[model samples]
Every structure is written in structure tokens, then in C-alpha cells.
Target: MKSTTLSRALLASSIALALAGCNSSNSNDGGGHTLPLEECKTYQSAPEVIVLSDNENIERQTITIGATGDMHGRIFAYDYALDSVDVNAGFTKISTLLSEERAQNPNMIMIDLGDTLQGNSAELFNDLPVHPVVDTMNFMDYDLWVPGNHEFDFERSFLDKNIQAFEQAVISSNIVWDKNSDACATNGEEVPFLPSYQIFEIDGAKVAVVGLTPSWVTNWQASSPQNFRNLDFKNELESVRKAVEDATAKHQPDVVIGALHWGRKDGGTGVHKIATELADYFDVLFMGHEHAQFIERVEKDGDYTADQLNISVRDADGRPQNQVEDKNISERYHSANRHESVKVIEPGSWGWALAKAEIELYKDADGKWQIFDTTLANRTVADIEEDAALQQEMQEIHDASVIDANTQIGTVDGNFTFTGHVSKFGGDEAVHEDPQFDGATNRLYTTIHHAKVADMPLVDFINQTQIRVIEEKATDHNGNPVKVDVSAAALFGDSSNLTDGQVYLKKDSANLYMYDNMLVATEISGEQLQNFMEWSYSYFNTYQEGDITVSFNKDIRAYNYDLFDGQGFTYEVDIAQEPGNRVTITSIRGTEFDKDATYVIAVNDYRFSSTMVPNGWVSEEDELWNSADETVYAIRDMLTEYVAETGTLSAGEFTNQNWHIVQYGQTDAEGNLVGDKGALLKARETEEGSKLWQQLQNKEICVVREESRDSDITIAVNYKDGSTWYENPQPGTYQGCVH
Candidate 1:
């Protein structure tokens, strides 16, 4: 039976519900109907039941599969130096490379693993009714497309509209809709949102391709409940297994391939394990989602008997093998009687490269096609020349986006720069000592200074916008405007020359968006707030007295470093301290912080959804408001409005320096300092030495570096009440953090 007919017959209810969710009145047009399963059917008959036809003739054939994913709307390459030079990997170059490959082999299949849309600033002005990326893909004649998690960032209607506009067959085995609501329900079973797989006839050979998505879509940081309300994600492996079984049963395909949208890194779910366990079922696996490039060949030796197995297995080359002997190896070998091997590859994101898998098949004695050999290659786009015709075709859209990005929003009297010398060891004076140290660490310090240390106009401006907007829309249960205690912002994207006294909504059309544009508000106890600050503090790596450079933890997302405004708090960071214990909130608005007190906080969506709660730095249950649902405008739009209305920007208006960082130390009850005060003093006297004494005198924090022959470094922090805490540096060769 045809896949569409069977799907319609089985999932009539699901189709109806999906159409309803799309808010379409006409179901006859098939606007939001699920894809039929038979389209990807593999075998001509069930593998267990099929009888081999002795007379069938099998011939040698070769096929090439080219794949790319997570392009993220990077249609044009970037020239970082000139900013608009268009000199690197992009769709135009990718198209040229794919075309060249196709010329070499007419039997090539082009597959996009997923995350093709979104990410570019141009997407903001993409009101042309036609998605440029989809148009480009159609021009390239893409064979199949899968939706990545980011595809669901927009509302369901938007997603449905885009899917309707695409010409390629979309496939995902796991996404399903409610089956009870449509007339086509077969036993009330849920049906796939898209075809589970597809079959291609390459030189008289049938090759089956199955699709899989990340099973944890609902929990995605960017996915809101409203965007994917009616959709359900099933176990990725189970979905693929079912699809493989169905395909093998009906088509008896000679080759089975998997085009999966799941990634193998950053704690991605199932795809890695699925590739390992199901190696025998698939000939090739195309994977994405981590935005990384990788290729690996996974092999499983057939189970061995006790006599055939040893403590370790070695190949003829005397090299150690990666084989493990299972206790039930004999059972598996007797039951399945086969070994498994599969090749997996992923192209890096943003069209940097394309993953190519070559499959060579030859006829076996039994007249069945058998894999002769397989090879994987990653073709990089760094040196590939852009396709001139395609570039010309997209040039107009690119120009328009550039113009939109250059639209002037406002002007400032002074430059907003991220450069300065700031470190935990010394205060702002560190910049005076080492100019190269300025960038992120200094900007971070400034952010904290403006947010909590003093009346920071920039952060305050952002806070006021969020607070005013939220107040206008939402109220407390008693109908009063909800009061917010803290507001946060991040220095997203590269710093621009706003110092020229003019500001555009974006730096240029090429660099158009700041990431901290989505706002979310939540309520948390003071303890949670402190914990959140501690999480921010985790960005800094601990350093000792002789450590010349104070660096940041590379593993932490740079954008997650947030500066909080609306609260007055001072913190002391001992680089030598552990993560959770590094930050000590000295006071709030000149008073001791009440740990049990509840405070409302306003933060960007990226910060709230992904960094804070998802990372376990904050609790999701404490969320009080999400700007995505509560407001009509994003934080960027709000900033635009605020700037346009105010007409002028001044650093003094936003500059608040209320908080200061102190190098942590310890002292005794009698207020006498301990440890290597001489080392600390000698280090401070050097040109590169952290001027700890000056910083302490300026900030009035009772911290002193003391000398001791027995200790490498000793720190003493005195309280205003005459009590002191003393500490000695832990012993270790300090290796800086990793990215």
C-alpha cells in the first residue's frame, strides 16, 4: 500500500488535530497532514519471511551521500576583519562544492540534517514571504530535510507555513500528533508528523534512509510550551527501530541509511548510543546538532565462545582492539550469527564543511547486493570559491538586510567599550598595568559595577524598560504592579564603536543582533539569588599570588556572564576557593541580605532558559513571568523604543559603581594577619604585581597579605567588628581552565 494512503487511513484523527493546531479551516488542502510511512519502506518483504529469488540479478553500483546541517541562516560568508567582506564558508560556496561533487557522480544525494533556518540578523527582516534559505535549498535540489529543535523556535503556525513552502520531503520518525481527533485514526494510534524514511533508486539499487530527531525536544532551552504544544517526541531508538522494521518488511532495501538530527556532544540524547547498538542495521549515519565536525567507524565483533575469547583482544598487527567480551556473547552469536559495522559523520555548522559518504555495492553469489566498501570524507568550504550566479541572486536580499542593520537608532555622548584592565587580583588598575588583559574580564567587572556596585545607567536603563513593560501588562494578585528587585543583561556580540556618538540598531547589516534580547522574569529567594551570583562567579578561575594572569573558565558560555542591576551587593572572590563557595554577598542596599526574602528578577530569555535554570543554577518553578508570552516586543525592540524616545545616551546616566571585588583572605581573632605576607608584599611591589594593598585601601575591605615561611601565601580578612578570618593557599601546580 502507498505510505500516504496507509498514513491517512491510520492517522485520520492525528491529521485532523494537526490541521486544527495549524488553525487552518480547510483540511482538504493537506496543509498540515503527516507524511505517509510507506514512502521510506525498505525491504520488499519482511526480512524474516522473505524468500530469496534465485534468478534475481544484482549489479555493482556506487552512490555518494552529501550532508550538511545547522547552517543557521549563514547564507553568506563573513570577513571578520572588514566585517562585510564575505570571504569564508557559506551556502554559495557550499552549492558550488556540491555541484562539483554531483558532476563527478550523478547518483549523489544531498541531505540537510536540520537547523537550516534562524540565527542570522537577516532573519529579523525576512518579511519577503519566501524564506531565502528554503529558496536556496530548492534551487540546490535538496533531496531530504529534517527539522532541528531550533525549527520550533517560532510558533506552530510559522513552522507549518515554512514546511508547506518547502519542496523537499521532510522526515522525522519520532514527532507525532494526537490520533484521537481525526477521522483517519486506525485503532486510535498516533501518527508521525513527517515521513519516517525515504527510499531512493540509485542505478537499480534501492537505498532506504531513515530520520531521527533529538528525543528531548520538549526540554530544549529555546523551545516554549506554546510552540510545540500538540507535538510528542518518542524514544529515538525505538522510533528508528520501528521504521527500520517496517522498511525492511515491505521494500527489502539493499542498503539502509540514517539521516538523524541528533548530536553526539554536549550531553545530546540517544544518537550516540543508537549508533553504537544499531550498527548492524544501518550502513551509514548522518548526524548533527552539536555544530561540530566528526567522523568515526564503529565496529562490533561477533560474539565469541569462551574458548575464542581472552582478557584482551588484539588484531594481527598486535594492536589492542576496542572489543569487549559479553557474558551472553555465545547466545548473541548463535542467535544473530553476524557482526556489525557502521560509519558515522557530522559536518560542522554554518556550512563550514560537508560530510560525504561513499557506498560501493557489488553482487554476491546469492544475487543479493553486498557492501564492497565504504569511505567517509569531510569536504571543507574554507577555500571553495563562491558560486557567482547564486551570490548575485542572493545579493539583493543581502543588501536589504545590510541597509536594515545600518538604520540608526540613537546617539551616545561617549564610547561604550569592553576594554580595560580588570581582574580579581587587582581592581581596575590592572588595566593600567597590562593592556592586553582588558577585554572580557574588564567588561565583566564593569557590568557588575554598573549593576550592583553603583547607579549604572546602562543596566538601569535596561531594567527600567523591562520593569515598566511588565508592570504595564502584569500585576500582583491584588492588582498592584509587580515590583522587581533585580534586572540583568549581558554584553552579547562583539563590542562596536558606539563611542563615535552614533548608534545603529546593529553595528552593520552583517552583525545585526545581540543575543540578550529575550527577556524573562522570575521570583527567587535571596539564597537562590546568591547561588545565581555564585554561578556567575564560577566563570573566573582561581589564582595564587605568583599567578600573573587572571583568566576566565573557558567551559562557561561567555554570554552567560551577566551583570545584575537594581540590587546593591558586594562580593569577595577567592580564586583559590571552590565554585559554590567563591562568592560571598556582603550586603544588599547597605543592609545584610535576608536569605529567605523573595526577590523578583528580570533576565534575558537566553539567560533564564538555558544558563540559569537549565544549568541547575536556578529553579524553573520560581519563574513568575516569561516575556515571550507576556510582551509583544523583544528586549531589542524595547531598547530601540527606549533609545528613540530618549534621543540621547550618556555614560554618566547609566554608570553606577556600587559593588567591588576583593581577593579573599583570612585573619585571626586578634586581627593579626598570617601566611606569606612578604611574598604578597614582594609580588605587589613588582610592576606586574596585583596592587592588593592599594585596592584594599581604596575599597576599605579588611583584607591583608601576610608573610609566613611555612606557607606559600596567607590571606587575612578583617571584619568591621574586629573579627578576622585567615586562609592559606592550597598546594598545586595551577593549570588554567579550558574552553
Candidate 2:
């Protein structure tokens, strides 16, 4: 079971490469070169073939199913630094584990659940003529594969080419070519992109493997609809039902297994609900998408009654009903039905683990194979030794990526550190004051303030790129070249904290990949613009008079924080105000605010697709431009080009301070301060006060302390409409300053 032994075992089998169809030419051909496109078009044209046979005389048979999903381009074992030790994970180790299992049972079948082509630096090889991951998968000899939603991240042509490179069967029951396209039709019916399912005859047992992908691919922000315009993603459950029925009628297999790219959560999709309702049809369900490891076993015996499973059932009104459980199968019964035993397993993402389902099948007197028992377990990569040969093979790809990542794109004059949030919270002082604030000091906060609350160099850089792109390609409704008046940007992911005065050489490109590569142009009214700012301000909790700290709402995600550039607008966020009323636009571009004016805005796809912001600020109808070129021009690339064009970059040239915060309260009838205004002001001067002051300085928040002898502790806040009073409040509760 050692990795060295596994490598030798794998090398001894010449059939691996031939079976995977990775060899360019036939094994008998001396060239051993990859076949040309004309000869390798086997995506859907190949029919199912029986590869193994089962002995009827044998009383029982066992099959091991090793499953992996969301590998995300991780080809080698990597050392992940945890709190105490380094944990290793990757396909290199997984290969050894799987090899040991296959050696024990030649009947073992390996499946990849999907989401394999995207996520890592190695994915850059996707555009290459021969993908490295394809080579690795062929080396590992995967039995079956399913396409995850991320597979559509690339154009149809690129995806199609990769599919043709796979030697094993690629199955997806729900994805089909456009029905109306006569070009892809066969006998007037739309042709499928891949086979729906494949029947594998392993030692005489006919096992049918069906694949299902998420239907929400069309709605994912990262996915471009135009890229998949030729395909349609059908409802998962309905597709599974149809595929199961078709496969059973055609093959009448001994067991049916599902390789689903959907996860357990609802997430605007009914994946979990559908999978539960149709549990009986699948002997084992291998799932992915959430990137979490889970194993569940559902069992039912002859003595078990349906009532036990229906106890928590709800009525149409969403209330618990006391009626007797119905035996007849209905949608409600289907929802509550767990009549048959089932087992579901999901391996964690990034090759951290593998899900193994071992099933024991018994041949009855009638010669029919039935599942006698089933067990599932998740094996972690941390527990296994890596395959040295596999690691050596992947090292070449990794070294190439490192070379590409370190290629000097441009240089910066000043340090562009990801300390925006930390600087706002007074850096180390904030963490020292309250340990709870430590979580906010991580990478998520580094660029939050720079991109969300205030104008910083990062947003300015992205905005400049967007503006340039929009000006070059965008047009108005009249077909006239349109100019973007304002640009919006957001920080998409975590990065290594960029140090001050550090030169951003080619080596720095890897850290900059988190921001999206494409830009989107859209139109927005002045009112919607204010609403967008208000949504950004909603990240903070209301500042009460007695509160010791100013903190962000725990419910808010750091990536959701966005800031606007291009327009010189000054706004104030009165934390004492209500959620939607927190942001007030005082002026725009040094002029009076006009609610009726419409402006062209450029933003990234992530911000453009966000629905968490209220008032429907970003709608598909308003989108005027999107980057859909065959060669992707991402924000990082733009930065590189900009830096190359202009020798040096400076934060001083890009940073803009147009917004601030005003913490005010109401005055009593006697014109005296009310509530805990005094106590809160005093707390702001304490060790906790460091973050408050830091935030005030970082946000340019103006605080006027008019020392008065008035006994009532209240603060007065002035508004464009009228003056209002704010009082002490608690967490999760807010009090509006009257307008």
C-alpha cells in the first residue's frame, strides 16, 4: 500500500493510458502521439460497451466505488499550514490510496464528481493544446466523469475540445444542445452534449452510473450565459428521474448509482429535496458543490413503518399536521418518504479526501443480483503517503505556473497593502482591545475599507481598467459610443498582505488573481446609486451612545462590501440611522445631487449580479456591456498593462476621500444631551477608543464634541430634511434618527 509500490503497480499496466484514451495514436502505432481532431471525436458517438463479466456461480460480489469532486486543478500533494501542523492533500496521495484499493479489488471503479478544471493556478494550462489535468486524470485512469457548473466557465469550443480528450465516458443527463438549433439536431431532436449514463459490466455485475449537474449554472455570477448559449440545464430531479427510467428500461442493470454535482443545501436549488425524494432509485449517491465532507445512511426494515418518517411532515400552510400518514405516494409523501434505505457520501474539495462506498451484492436463487449491504467512509489524504512519480509529473506543471506567476508584469512606487480594514480599526490596537475583532483583521478586511467604505488605490485601479474597457467597447441605445461617468468595483477574494514600498513584479500576479478579470457596463439612476451606497453602509451595526466598539454586522460577507469610483460624491453614514437611511448623498462631482439624472456605470460581474443589495440596483436589463472575448482580459491583466504603460504607480494619485461618518444623537426638550451619549464618548477615548478613532480617521468621519454642562446626555444630528435625536441602542437593534 506504500506510494512507491502503487507507482510501480500503475506503471506495469500499459492498458491505463489506452483505456483512458489519452494516447495520441493507437497503442500499436509507433508514433504514440495524440490523435488528430478528426480521429478523436468520441464525446457522444461511442456506444456503451461491456468490459467485465460476473460469474453466475458466485454467491456474492463486492465492488468499491472511489469518488472525488471539486479537485479544482490540485494535481499534487500540498502542505497546508494549520494552527499546529502542516496537513497534506492532493491527487498524488489520493492516487496511492486508490491504487491500493484497486489492487485489492480489480472490480473497483473511480469517478470524478466534477468542478475539476477551474480554481487553481494550474488551470492556466486549460488554454494549452494539451491540458495537464487531462494527462493526470488519464494517468490515474478515471472510470467515469461528470461536468460541474464550473466546466461552463470556458467557451463551448474549449470545453468541447477537453471533453473529446477524455478516454472514459463523460455523462450528464440534464445538459443538452439547444433544441431549436437545427445544426445540432438528429432526427429533429436536440442532440445531447454527452452520454446521459453508462453501464459498466464489472465481474458480471451490470452497474449503471448516471450523472447530474446543478441547474443553477445559468444563474451563477461567475458563469457567462453567452458561453453556454448552445446548451440548456434542465431541472436536476426531473432529469434524474427520466435518466433513471431510461437507463433501467434500456440496460436493466443490477445497481444504479448517481454522480451528482449538486450539494445538500437548498441555495435557491432543490438539489437536496430532489435527491431525498428519489432515494430509492439510487443505490448510492455521490455528491459535490458545497466543498464539504459528509456521509449519511438511511435505513428501513420490514418492521419500519412510514409513519415514523412522516412525523415531522408539515401541511400546505407550513404547520405540523396531526393527520395519519398516507401510504399512497404523492408529492407530499415523496417529501416525507424514506421507505427505502440509502447512503449519500461527499468528499471534501481540493482532493482533501475521497469518498468510498463498498457494496456487497448477493445473487439470489433466481440469478438476480440484489444489494445485501452497503457502507460508506471518507478517507483523508493527510493519512496517506504521496505517489512520488505523480508528484514529479505535476512538479513540471507547478514550476511552469510559478514561472508564469512570477513573470514581472509591472512595478509600483508605493506599497499597496491589503490593510484597509485593519487601518480603519487602528491595526494591532484593535485586536488588542477586543479579541473578537481578531477575525476582522484577517485577509477579508485588508481590502474591505479600501474597496467598500472609502476610495482607495485598489478600487481606483480596477475602476480605471473598467472605464478604459467601457470607453473602448460600450455603446448607447442609439448606437452611439457611450462614455462611463462612474465606475464601481469590489474586492473578490483574499490575498497575501501587500507590504508598503514593495515592488509588484511578475511574482505578484498570483496574489492579484482574486479580483475578477472581466468588466461589466451598466446604467443606473441617481436614486439607485444612493440605494447602492446605503447597502454598503448596511455592513455596520448602529452606533449607540454607550457602545464600547464600532463593529461590522456579523451577517455581512467581506466580499459583498463594494465602493464606487469615477464620481466625486461626498456621503455621510449616520450609524444611529436605520439601515436604508444610513447613507445620505450631499453632493456629486462637486455639484448638487440630482435624483432624476441617469449615469453610465462600469462594474465587475460579481457586483453586477449581486441581489443582496436592496431596491434592485443592478438588473440584467440595464447591463450594456460585458467582456466576452475568446481571450479573457481580467483586472489583473489590465493592472499589468497599466503598470507597463506607466512605469510607476502611486496611491496618492488614485486615493480619493469623498465620504465620512457623522455620529450624532437627539436632544431633549430642554436642549440637553439624552441617553448614554456621554458614556459612549468617554469609551471612544479608551483602549477600545483606538479603533473608533482609527475608523474615524480612515473614513474621514467628522465628530464635533461641543462640551456642554447640560445634564441630559443626548446628541443632535442634522439632516438635509430636518434634525433628529439618537439614543443608546443594543446589538441587533437599531433606532432611526428622525428626518
Candidate 3:
């Protein structure tokens, strides 16, 4: 039965490949379009082929598999948003590598792990007859296509179009049609959104490829449920296991591969857990969605070890060896499994590298073809030149995207991002060079390190835009007009900043607000708001007695670190306090805060679904409004709309100066911050004897923490003119310093 279904598919594919070979004459460009052979002939480089296992058996057979994912629509080696030529990454470069590899070994299987249709300049061609990215993949002859979470970021029709346009098998076992819903009703028939898996006969041995998409798409795209429409993203582990078992029981594939559109440690359904739980079922797993690169081998008992071939190419026994870096590598496991280990490989995002797995097969005593050995490598495309033919074909699409991205939307007179020195001292002299800097009113920019450590104009701009959009269009649960008192938003891009007196283009807006999250207004008590702030501020590392520089917790993601701006409110985050005790609301609407008082707050729909509702901080039924209901659905669009309407961009219109972050070395009997790092902060109110603050703000002076002669903590200041000011201040024994 399995042979009857899959054999026909494979036969059709082979026939198509033969026709493509005949049509191209030189290369097998699977797409119907003729190849620009003469243009590409010069740029073609010889492929580097390395034997994974040392074998001389004549009966041994081999199959090379190539994989890519988290591409995010980087079709060409050009950044449309930045309007610059990115020489390092893009699918065009990967195409060159693919052509070279295919030339070396035509038995190769090409698979795209997904996240292929959203970023870079892919959205520009969404309404076209065929998406350029899909067209390029077709031209490259990709065999299996797996859908990633971001693939559903656009409209359902757009996603449907691309899926239909792909010439190969687009498989995902977990995404099934919601038969219970009217939109996807199949008259009580159970139906998967796409085929569960695809089997191919390579070198007379059956190879099965099963696809699994992340189940958490429901939470990420909660704001726009219509993107997925009637599709249900089922549990990853269950769906994938069923698909693998079914394929094995029927086809008995020589090698079972898991084309998982998920990261290695993405909560429960990560490839590490899947490899451990379903070790016997899978031979290799190709991963994506974290945009990271690594090749890890996991034991049947879940013992993990990573073999990074790019860092150091030495082979340990049969596995490559290297130390895992701080950037989320797998843990070392001393325990070993008696059975064969599962191999998992992931290529970094944006077409930086191609994840390759070479499997060697040999006949067993029973005359059945079995996997002899497997080796994985993430082949880099940084040195590989972009395929000339691919470039020529995509030149028009590239030019149009660049022109759209560079269209000037507005102008800014000053920098919206913090760029100066960030001192613990918030004194008057340390205030921003801008004449409008004010501390008590919260309309101020002191030192530069304000973004994650303290509130700044960059974050304020997003919060203000969200609040304005909600206040203008949102209504209460009963359809009455609503007023938004506070708004919270996270800084999505680290390099998101606007230059002074520069023409703000569409790209700049996209950089500032990177996601397509819709706005939502909700009602919560003062206590809940404080708790939310505390949770967000927990991203910071607690200040110790001797710590001079502020740092953040590496375990937390920057997107989860949110800041707030309100119509009338001021608060402080004390780094000296613990995570849960950091936030303190000083005033609300010029009055002292009451924990029991209720307030209306606006935030992105992602936060409303991923955090507030799930944490029981806010009820879903009491939700006030959703921006999706209005014409301006995305926050990114609302930002452009706000800027377009305002005509001019200025800090005065957005920055609320409602929040401050403080770290103190000593406190008085009444818990007041005394002379130390604390005194410099309080001196801002008086604006007198602020010479030291001025020096620190201008980068003429630097602060350093060291140990004193007596082993006490010493606060030292180095002046530009070769002067040293040191102080060893202890509780009630303050040693003042002089330069």
C-alpha cells in the first residue's frame, strides 16, 4: 500500500527531474523557466566533497542531504530595509552552494526547514502570481518544504498561494484542518492541512522525511488568528511521533529524518526532547526557528553533546569536538547510550549556512539496506558568491523592494535612542545635552545606558504610539468610549535608533517596531501593574555592593523586557532590590498610588495572550479592545501612520519621562539614598555642585569599582586630566573623595 502511494510520487518527481535536465541542458533547474547558463557558468565553483566514513565496500551507498531554514525571505544578497548589499548572507548565495553540491552528487536531497516567506523583501511580492522566494526554491529544485511559525505571519491567502506554487512536496504532520470549525469543515472527515510526510527512493533505499511545525504559533499570532484561519497546530511531539511510526510501519525507510521547524530547546517540543523520547524512530533531525547554527548528537537516554564542525573540524572518534559557547549551546553529558545516538543539525538563519547531513548505507546480513553512519556539517555560504543567474532573475524584485524601503516617511530633529554614557548618577550636570531634559517631571535623558536599564525616548515612542491608537479607536466591553491611562511596550531591536536631522524612511520605522503585533487595551489593578513592571524589570541583574556596571540577566530575552509610559504616572526600579521587589510607583496622575485602584492599560496582543491572560493577571473576558478590529491592525503600521500624521518627529511628543532606574551603595536610616552613587542621583533636583556629573556625562571621567587596602569596596573615578578620586564609603562612615 505504501509503495503504491509513495512510489508514484517519487516516479513523478524523477520524470520531472529528467525533463528539467533536458530543458536546461547544463543544469537541472526544476522550474519551467529556462536557466541563464552562460551568465552562471563563470561564477560556478567546484564543490568540496569530504568522505565521512573510511570505507572501501563496493556494496556501500551514500546520500547527501542539504537543509536550510529561518531564511526569513532573504532571497538575494541585499538588505532592502537597510538599502545595502549584504555580502555575507542570502538564498542566492545558498543557491550557488546548492548547484555546486548537486553537481558533485545528484543523489542529494534538498529540504527547506521553513520561515521562508516573511522578512527581508519577500512581502513586496506577496500579491504576485508567484512569490520570488518560492520561485527561487523551485529553480533550485528543493525536495521537501516545511512550514515555520513566521510563514503564517501574513494573510492566509498569501500563505495558501505560496504553498500551492511550490513545485515539491510541502509537508507538515502537526498542522491539521479544524474539522469542527465551519471554515475547514470536511463533513466529519479528519484531514491534515498538508501531507504528513514524503518518502523518496534514493540509491534503491527508501528515505522518509517527516515535517513538524511549532505548536506555539497560536500564542505568537494570537492577535491575528485569521492568518492561520481554520488550521490547528497540534502538539509537536505526538504528531511527529505518529507520522514517523506510520511511515516506518508501512515504508520501513532506511533512514527516517525529522524536518523539525523548531529550535533544539524550544520549551517541551524541542528537538533534544524529541530525539531522546523518539530516538529509535529517527535517524537524523534537521532543525530551525532559533536562527542559530550547531550539530548536536543526543543519546537515547537524553545525554547531549554537540559537534560543531565549523569551529574546529577535528573528528572525535566519529563525532566532531568543540566547547559550547555562552550563546545557548548544549550541556555536556558524561553518560553514554548503548544504542546508536540521534544526530541533529541546524543552519543559522538568513542563508548564512547550509545544514548538511551525509548518510552512508550498507546491506546488512538480512540483505536489507541499513544506515551505516551519518556525519553532519553546517556549510557556510559567506565565501560563496551569489549565483549570477539567480541575481539577474531577481534584479527587478530587488530594485522595487529597495525603492519602497527607502521612501522617506518623515524627519527627526534629534536622536530618539540613548547614545551617551549611562552613569548611576542622575544629577543635573549629567542630564542630556538636549535643553529640554528634565528629571522631576520625568522629561529627561541623562546618560546613554537608559534603554534597558532605564526608560528612554526609543521605548517611549512605541508606548505613546500604542496608547494614542488605542485611545482614538478602542471602546470598553459595553461599547462605551475608553480612556487609556498607561501603555507598555518592549524594545524589539537593539540597533533601532534614528539619527538627528535625518530623513526617516520606511525601513527606519520597521527597525523601530520589528514585529506585526496588534494593540490591545485591558483593565488591571494597580497591584497587577506593579507586578507586571517587576516581572519586566527582572531582566536586570541585581546590583551588588561592589558592582559598578549594571547588567542584564542572560536567561531572559530582550523582547520580554517591557517598559511603560502613562498619561500621568512616575515609577522607579531599584536594582539594589530583588527581582520581585524592584518596582515602586511613586505617583499616578500627580497623586500617590493606591494598589487597589483599577487602571486601563494598552499593550500588544502578544503580551495580552502570552503573559497577562495566562498568568491570571487579567481576564480575557474583560478585554477592552483589539486593534485588529480597526483599519490599522499592526503596531508597525500605526507607527508609520502616527509619524505620517504628525509630519515631524520630536522627543517632546513621545517621551513621557515616567520611569527611572536607580542603584544605590548606601541608604540612610529612613531608607533614603545617601551620598555614594545615590547622592549623585538626588543632586539632580538641586542642580548645584554638579561638576562631577558634568564630567561623567561628557565622557571626560570614568568610574571603576575595586578593592581597598583593607579589602573593602572602593569607588574610584579616573579623570581625563590624570586625576584620581577614590572613596571607600561604608555604612555611617562616609569617606568623601576629592580630585
lDDT of 1 by residue, 1-739 (tens): 0011112232333333322211111112223343322311221211222121222344776678888888877677742212353433478878888888889886688889887876664344233334567767777777788888777655555456566556657778888764543433446567677778887766566778898877666665442565564667788878988988888788878778899987553343345566666777787788888665556555543221111122111223422221212223212211122236566677777786777877777776766677766666677675678877777766654554454445565777643332222322211222211111221111211111212211234444566667666766756545667667767665443322234255544432122124324566677778888888788867665645553223455456545656665646544455567677866666665578788888788877667766667666567776666666533446756666556667776655554443333441332221123333333334555653344334333432222212111111122321221222212132111111100
lDDT of 2 by residue, 660-722 (tens): 455422223222234444343455566645454554333222222111111111222222112
> What lDDT tens digits, residue by residue, belong to model 3 across residues 1-739?
0011112343344334322211111111123322222210111111111123333344667788899998887888776655666665688889888887888878688999999987774654554545668877877778779989888776566666667677778888888777777765577766777767888776467778899888888776766677777777888888988999888888888788889998766756677878888887787789888776666667675543342222224334332322121212332211122134566777777886888877777787766776655666777765578988878766656666666677677898655644334323222223333212111011122212335554557778888888777777877867888887788888765445665677877777776776767788989998898888889988766664333335456456567878888877778778778899988888876788888999888999889878887777888865788876565577877887777777788855665567666653233222233455553244432333255545454444443322111111133232222333323232111121111
Q: How are the candidates ranked when ordered by TM-score, highest leading? A: 3, 2, 1
Evaluate model 3: give its TM-score: 0.76
Model 2, stretches more than 4 Å misplaced? Answer: 1-42, 45-53, 78-89, 185-188, 219-226, 297-341, 417-456, 472-481, 527-561, 570-588, 592-596, 606-621, 630-632, 659-739
RMSD to true structure for each model, in Å: 12.7, 12.7, 12.7
Off by over 4 Å in 1: 1-58, 78-83, 125-128, 178-188, 221-223, 266-270, 298-341, 418-473, 494-502, 508-513, 551-555, 569-572, 610-622, 629-632, 658-739
Give all candidates' CA lDDT scores.
0.55, 0.57, 0.65
Clashing pairs for model 3 are: 421-448, 442-657
